[model samples]
Target chain A: MGFDGDDTLWHNESIFSMTQERFRTILGGIDAAEVDRRLLEAERRNLGLFGYGIKGFVLSMIETAIEVTGGEVDARDIQTLIDCGKSMLAHPVELLDGVAETVEYLANSHRLVLITKGDLFDQESKIARSGLADLFDRIEIVSEKDPETYRRVLARHDIEPERFLMVGNSVRSDILPVLEIGGQAVHVPYHITWAHEHVEPPAEGYRRIEGMAELTGVIAAL
Target chain B: MGFDGDDTLWHNESIFSMTQERFRTILGGIDAAEVDRRLLEAERRNLGLFGYGIKGFVLSMIETAIEVTGGEVDARDIQTLIDCGKSMLAHPVELLDGVAETVEYLANSHRLVLITKGDLFDQESKIARSGLADLFDRIEIVSEKDPETYRRVLARHDIEPERFLMVGNSVRSDILPVLEIGGQAVHVPYHITWAHEHVEPPAEGYRRIEGMAELTGVIAAL
Candidate 1:
């Protein structure tokens, strides 16, 4: 069994959303929607260069601030953005409801792997703080969670795709890729999704559960 | 056999060196040594929060700039630093002399693993661009290459420390940690070394080679 770190196990997207709100207030005169759109564009452009995590996001925010303000943005505002990033990095990892119980229950009967994507250091620190690191048989912090990456990971652990199962919040990252590689996936939607993570729901290939509390039942049914 | 990526296989520290010089010029009136000092201090302070990589380095540079300029630095100057970071990310991977040949020669007879520490995306992209990826049997990009990390990696791959041999440039990261775990290491010094990677050379346990050109001979003698 594989688990995704951000949003799936703990409150991740909410931190980003809250930071985005702070970003809007920092650039007070600009329309919030316009700021968001530009920021998202900068993020998309920088994804290949910076990859995932707060560091990259903050860089993008700074870039967007400069772009939107025609290089007239305050240096103190840039410092504020940097501070926001530091706080985000220091943000506490809050496990979602029933996550600990579900993960603990699964650990006794199955090998649990925490496969996440983001800044390597950030993810490793979050796992340490999550207080559930010991429950995992293995942890893989990858750059991107695509089919090729999943294939490589499964092969390294000597597991076939047919026996692999992935649980995460993003359909684009977790579900579609796993299903493409002939693995099973369970989608547990988070209240807030990043624009890049928004994807049309698959018609029928994977299972959908309301929350982690229902995970054991789904696993048993499988 | 494990190999270090930065400086060991390709040019890494030199890129950082060039960027630091650029940073000195950008900060203008500040003493070059002072700029370097403050930047290194920021890097050390931010290491826990930001980890290692160009992104974090750029962030530290920005922070240092703000400190030296007393929040009076131009926003355009900040943009220039960001641009420097982007260019560093896009910098082409230049394999050191005899590296490709040496790595390929060893790959024929041994399982070559690339164990590097840095941002996941940055390191992965470097590996891809290095053109030596295919020669490696396994590639481990970690956040920190410490004794415990080395132990876990060796255990995961079913390798005992005595049977493992690591080759790298940094005594701090690649040699000392491996030796602490009873593993063999060969130090191949690079022309340029980062301040954070500096440490007193270990007296006797590991062999020191002049360059990658001498690696094959050292391995055979061992």
Candidate 2:
């Protein structure tokens, strides 16, 4: 069994959303939703160049701030974004409901691995703070969650795709890619989702649970 | 045989040095070397939080800028730093002397892996642009090139430590770690080095070559 970090095991996207709100407040005079749209656009444009993480997000926010403010942004405004980023980096890791109980229960019967994508240090820090380190047999903080990445990871561990199961929150990131590679997957919906991570659900061959509390039942059914 | 990407295969640290010079030029009133010292300090402090990459370096620059300027840094100054980051990320991949000829020479009769550490997208882009992608059988972009990372990479490929060989520029990153794990290593010195990657040479047990042109001969002797 593989577990996704970020929004699956803990609260992640909501923190980003809250940070975006702070950005919108700091850089007023632009439509709030428009600010989000532009920031997301900047983020997408920068993703290939910067990769994903708070540092990239902060850089994208700075880029968006300059774009929205017509290059007349204040130093303190940029400083505010930097501070926001640092604060988020320093934020406490709060585990989701039933995450500990579910992972603990599953670890007893299965070889559990945590396959999540993001900045290496950020993810490692969160995992260390999440206090679930002892439960996982391996931790793979990947750059992206795609079919190829999943295939390589499974191959590295000598696990067959047909026997592997992936659980996460994002359809684009965590679900479809695994299913595409002939691996089983379970999608547990989170309260908030990044627009970039949104995708139309696939037609078949995956499980969906409303929350992590239902995970054990899903596993038993599997 | 495994190769290190950044300084070993291509021109990398010089670009960072050029950027640091530009950073000094933009933020006047401080000694140039003093600027470098502070930037290095910020980088070391941020290493665990931000990880090693261009993104982390940019964040360190911003943090150092604010520190040096006493929170009086100009918005334009911050923008210039951001532009510096973008320019670095978009820089072309220029292979070092004899790198192509050496790797090409070695690839014919050996299993070649490129093991590099940094921002995933940036490293991938450099590798793709390096025009040497077809030569490598596997590309491992790790978060850090430590003993555990080397061990994992070797194990994932089912390569034993005695049979594995690593070649790179930094003693801290490439040589000692491989040697510690019973793997052969060749250290080819680069003209520039990052402060964080500098370390006192180990007592023994690794080959040191002057350039990539000599790599083929070293491998032949082995």
Maximum-lDDT candidate = 1
Which window of 10 residues has the lowest lDDT sum in candidate 1 chain B? B152-161
lDDT of each: 0.95, 0.90
lDDT of 2 by residue, B54-131 (tens): 888988898898888887787667878888999999999999999999999889999999999887778878998999
What interface RMSD does each of the candidate structures achieve? 0.6, 2.0
Model 1 TM-score is 0.99
Looking at candidate 1, what TM-score does chain B attain?
A: 0.99
Kindly give the number of clashing pairs for every candidate. Answer: 0, 0
Q: Over the stretch A1-222, how does candidate 1's per-residue lDDT look in tens digits?
A: 899999999999999999999999999999999999999999999999999999999999999999999999989999999999999999999999999999999999998899999999999999999999999989999999899999999998999999999999999999999999999999999999999989999899999999999999999998
For residues B113-166, write the lDDT of model 1, one tens digit per residue.
899999999999999999989999889999999999999989888999999999
- The collision pairs in model 1 are none
At residue A106, give the lDDT of candidate 1.
Answer: 95
TM-score of chain A of 1: 0.99
Report, for candidate 1, the interface RMSD: 0.6
Name the best candidate (by DockQ): 1
